[model samples]
Target: MDYLSIANGRVLYILASIVIIVVIIQSVLFLRMSWKRGISIGISKTKLKETVKTSAFFAIVPSIPIVIALIAISPVLGLPFSWMRLSVIGSQSYEMIAAKIGASSMGIANLTDPGYTAQVFSNSMWVMSVGIIWGLVLSIFALKKYQNRMKIVQKKDSKWAEIMVNALFFGMLSVFFGEPIVSGGLSLLVLLSSAAIMLFITWIAKITGKQWIRDFALSVSMIAGMAFAILFSNLGAV
Candidate 1:
């Protein structure tokens, strides 16, 4: 079989293609924004850059599991229909067309034929392409809204709101992109932990006249720092 027929080869190629395309687009936008701002260190710039990079990265990251799933359903070249004759064509041979159609239909519901693999792959790729585009547009809109919001708030609770929204957005990305570290239990833990930590520090800063702002700043700093660290670490590992 050709390299594209191999599990790792085909899967990696699909994911890498998606990642490269998304990253290039995202990077160009990011560079344009950064250029316009002169690398401003305000809340929005930091948050936007971080969010775009992480979201784009994780978006492609989900493809790994997807590819593995595709490979699992494929025949083993010599063991055809024994395991799932209903889904296979012949003994020790793959029902290539059916498998393709099944995969392209996004979970094998509409694939009634028995020999159309290319159709499945093509359809699925088109679907994924659309999803990627939608995600990128949403990311851009979200960043714009966030930056606009940052320019208006100046009161004590403003920073808190910014932090909260950042957390929520990050959580959304985590949920949407299938970040493994943000599993159910871990998500709850991160939420409770960041909330508790932020509240405690903010309250202490409120009561004390000296460096309360500093303490609050430190708290927010730690949260952002830790999150950035965790995300980049995961990116490197992935």
Candidate 2:
């Protein structure tokens, strides 16, 4: 009857599991098709295998942050909803803000508060769902058009187009890099430590030609950051 109970119910877990299974199936199918296409295009088996290995390594790095996000959201949204949202559509920051807005609309302080009822949970779900729907809609309908426009721009001036793309990426990275500074204290330390670790790993990779270390540098840096966070917290540095 309550939000917590409904959020953690077996039925929800079953549904979430189904969604995850479907995603896994789709991913496997895509991978298989891509591999076959690579071979058909005259790509060697050795190169294809290396591509797969590199992709898996790169995937592990981003996935660590997603897993961390899942843990952060699970306490409020419960495992089922958190898993599904993060796995399906929402990023950690977006999902949290959406949930907060949803709860606030119902006059609740936060997801974990005593006043967070079933209705509040429903509101949060709706907000989170609707918040992310626009992105999907754009991807489905407008992404190709946007990409085609970019392609034209690239064709006109390849170097400028590359610079534009890099600028966009840098802008996005700036927001994340600046976030810890605004948060201050332990967060800032963690961010700096992560950056330092990543840089060090990159340097080592370049010097020693350790391709595997370069491939997994992001994940190692993230883990190092998380460890530093814990250390700082325990030391009352935050």
Candidate 3:
């Protein structure tokens, strides 16, 4: 039946298309919301919808790059090692993340098993969903408590953080799913592109006149670091 092979190919195409489409849509919405509101609206309905869409799209999009990178690396390291290497990078992810959060590092060990990728993916999906809801709830609470000026900053930070967390979880999910789609030089190209996107997001957020821009800066760095780690471990010269 070649079920494993067939299923893997299907997943590659499905996830790739969904991730690309969602990212494009989210980017357009982001530009539109920023242009229209100019950091004034506390929370526009249009912006809210865009944020939600971006959050949902980001929840899984980050995984696509890793999945594709692994697929690309599968030839060099075989199926499972490519996946294990990705997880190893994630093991130290929380350490750097904790440091950013002003907390002591929490050493997370790599599961490093082929079967573990699926479990990690499942866990990430659950966590991302929960975080999105929590972030939204917190944003509402902040908006009510803070003044209008603060609300604008708070809203943007909240949405940006929500998207970052979603991206983080999706990156981890890629480790769990363990599908490879790219290889050779193409793999490296994709990894660099992913990093460029993350960097661009950080740069844009920082340059904006908004006050809470710093909050998003660190979060973007954290998310970028996590994704880069996975990409490097899986794609680096392998």
The stretch of ten residues in a row with the least summed lDDT in candidate 3 is 99-108
Return the top candidate by lDDT: 2
The candidate, 1 or 3, that scores higher on lDDT is 3
Question: What digit string (tens of lDDT, one per residue) describes model 2 on residues 37-69?
Answer: 999999999778867777776676568789999
Model 1 lDDT tens row, 76-170? 22122112222211222234443444465665454433433444545544453443355557766797886666666535477787797898899
For model 1, give the 10-residue run with minimal summed lDDT.
77-86
lDDT accuracy of residue 66 in candidate 2: 91
Global lDDT of each model? 0.50, 0.88, 0.50
Give the C-alpha miss distance for residue 23 in model 2, angstroms.
2.3
Q: What TM-score does model 3 achieve against the real structure?
A: 0.28
lDDT (Cα, tens digit) per residue for candidate 3, span 1-238: 3323532455545654565566678788987877668547566666556565555655564666677766654443234434543433332233223222221111224333233333343343344334335555777788666567655655779887668668889999677334334343534544455557667776777678553443344445546656666776686534
State TM-scores per candidate.
0.33, 0.76, 0.28
Where's the lowest-lDDT run of ten residues in candidate 2? 53-62
Instruction: Report lDDT (Cα) of residue 226, candidate 2.
Output: 85
